[model samples]
Target: MPSKIQKLEPDRTTIAIGLEGSANKLGVGIIRHHPRPDKSSPKPPAEILANIRHTYITPPGEGFLPRDTAKHHRSFVVKLVRQALKQSGVSIADIDCVCFTQGPGMGAPLQSVAIAARTISLMWDKPLVGVNHCVGHIEMGREITGATNPVVLYVSGGNTQVIAYSHQRYRIFGETLDIAVGNCLDRFARTLHIPNDPSPGYNIEQLARKGKHYVELPYTVKGMDVSMSGILAYIDGVANDIFGGKPKYTDDGAEITREDLCFSLQETIFAMLVEITERAMAHVGSQQVLIVGGVGCNERLQQMMGMMARDRGGAVYATDERFCIDNGIMIAHAGLLAYETGYRTELEDSVCTQRFRTDEVFLAWRDD
Candidate 1:
């Protein structure tokens, strides 16, 4: 496609521009990876040249559809790319590769962004690197938190998994048997008619903070896997009943409020996550736990995870919204790593899929 893959010189800095529109959010980011003087040394830190995103939000009690989300991404991707390049202060010619999310997302949204990436790759004469969405989260989390090797709990809207690195792959130790954790929260938020302005999950977290009671919900954890669909269905019914003026109360005779439902749901789901994550850590014989993805931004989840890791005499690592939420920077960082290892995705093979799994990606940049 391009002339020839550029060699990553040890003394040179590699720059990549990444585009991400896997879901409702469209993002563009530029990142710089400075190489170590000694090639045998461990990798150095990455520099975030520019990180920008625009979200497509629906009204209260609604979810974003694939068609609308794709339109939103198409509308903003080019503008975001331009802004990212300008903010990075880097010329297009200086970019080594154009990276984009290739899978594990809504088909239309992923295709919309991939088309933009393909167009840029051809226009700028740069190679293209297709990144796995889940792998992008893991790589960016490791870079931001410096968690060398940790049992990763990846919680997002479309996916939920507990992972560990092994044999040049991110192996999924356990995952949701039903809907994802974030999806459960989002659906519950819709049941409550909460605003999806910032995020339904964030609003739910805020409401949960004011809760003084806990209404027990189904705890579905079978072996290492967890289930949230039943819980969501159960809670949805409870929420509807409460809204319909049905009497519901806690064990202490206190009437359960909306805030209490949010609180109880958060606690129950987070506990299931903690249980699986701890089990994964034990299975891998590692104490470190790293949380990534959009729902990983939940402070309650982080606190609970931290408590679990501490109980095992280890530490938990998590990032704020910037790195935790889906963004182009993570795609850029992870893609650049693969690019440096001589991985490339030709134009024809750069097609995006909606069902890519985390374990499907080969971690060529990491040792066995």
Candidate 2:
């Protein structure tokens, strides 16, 4: 077992290197954070020394596999690490800790990056920090947008949740009971044989912009929880029938186009998401809504969220694609925050899992 590491004073500046490979993307980032003595004072700026990422793209109509994604991470993680260190102008000796995503992701992919992080920690003689993926997104979003204690709507291929911070814990107000929102969109893209070069969801969004009409699809919102699997199934059937030269008319005899389906899907799902997010904000009495995770980059979703927040006399906050998508900067930023709070993952205890929940991590850094 690795020896117990000593805690550092929170008043000093700390540097952390974070590795993220919870899914198809592999990222390496370095961050420097300066903590202030006064807890109520403004949060000090967290500098991004280096932030680099690479994605593994599969063919159209295909989803990424665990083994393949792991291999992809292992193959490029070293190169990314080297590049990030060089880009950041920081040597291994300058880093105070190494961090990695621990869970709520693919088991093999998470394991692959965790192994790299553990090896790096031992090589550099730095302590290890385990980061939660969802929390990483939330923290990064807050830092970039300066949304203090906002309602977070985290949407990605693997997760769709409405969250609010309370008692130092990020509580989930609502989430998808089945497949996530991004997963639902990707599967529907596969049914339509859409290319997955950049992202299926991106392609769908682009196609949606060309649509002038809407085709009806099931909108499954059970109170705060949503059921996207049924909607995906229905859309997939519609896409298959349309592609198979079957009747392409709605029940009202209106013609159904591919663009129409995409538009309708985006409108329906995004509206559902906005509804749940608004509900969360109302429940928490928060005026700000912050959207995080990969799918949060969607413009239509942002527009819908903005409208909802405006209706409630509130505001919506979001980051660009760089921070919105899963990246190393988030993990690095979040991990450094934890490290300052005296949280570290010993080498022997840095085991990665596939089911780590966001609320599992104790919040020692936040006073609110």
Candidate 3:
């Protein structure tokens, strides 16, 4: 932790509106941060005035495209924004700043949401705060679960990383060298013809619950990082073989089912995650583990993480879909924290990107 830099005065409250549409979901959220009465303490508990989202679901055997996703965001963002403001009962003038995710997502969707956010900031005369998508998830997880200084396992459709804080930065201890864990699941779900109603991963989790056989799949963990491309390719090939009536079976001569495939994939990938997260925790000398991002909502992953943490005599912290999934509230929550440290994204510099790493942002509000 670095020396505290004075930004906000004591006992003052700041309200922010956040916009998020990095991928298939477009979210609008309102958040209020109240400075602690005692300046020595950290920021007080944040209030989530309103957090609303609308998702764009594609048909089975297909993944969402950047172009189509952006169109969906453009269509629904304004409606969600209006609903969020009305639900929060906060007037536009009450908002202190407008926050939006600036990077680490699909280019088209990010740009669409960025345009919306810039419009809002200009219209409301509020300052803009460009937030990193991964940091948003991490900070919101810490705030919601009160897990300070825990090792973070950020898993999502486009990212997989093990993170920990050191020297005023959220350092990445490990990450995926290939496809993300969620991407593997989503693609596999498509191969199985699973519906993408709520989410492909959620549907796979449900199917995995009915699975009894543990079909062996390649479990590849390279040191602190994991690679899912090979696993996905192997599973897809097996699924194709099964679909072609080519008879695939386990080593014990038992036939494989779609349920078994999902079960094996989940168990194998989650174990690799737990292994790497545990390794990072041990390296950092911390026991607490916090899981965030879209894939963190899986109950089985939570259970596996809890077991790993319990074995180390620590605990696992997590949030439900509202905070776990890509949403505006986390962006608002994290951007508010940065804004408290006098961080601002000038209108001219409020550009969105597709490759913002977690360690790029400097943690100015932290004194730990």
- Tens digit per residue, CA lDDT, model 3, 192-248: 999999999999999999888897789999999999999999989998999999977
**TM-scores across all candidates?**
0.98, 0.97, 0.97
Scored against the true structure, residue 145 in model 3 reaches a CA lDDT of 98
Find the candidate with the highest lDDT and give its number: 1
Best by TM-score: 1
The runs of at least 3 residues in candidate 1 whose Cα sits more than 4 Å from the true structure, single-residue gaps closed, are 1-7
TM-score of 1: 0.98
lDDT digits (tens) for residues 13-72 of candidate 1: 999999988998888889999988796887779999999999999999999999999999
Which candidate do you rate higher for TM-score, 1 or 2? 1
Reference-based lDDT, each prediction: 0.93, 0.90, 0.92
lDDT of 2 at 135: 96
The list of candidate 3 runs beyond 4 A from truth reads 1-6
Q: Cα RMSD (Å) per model?
A: 1.8, 1.8, 2.3
TM-score of 3: 0.97
| Worst 10 contiguous positions by lDDT, candidate 1 | 1-10
Spell out the clash pairs found in candidate 3: none
lDDT computed for candidate 3: 0.92
Candidate 1, residue 137: Cα displacement in angstroms equals: 0.3
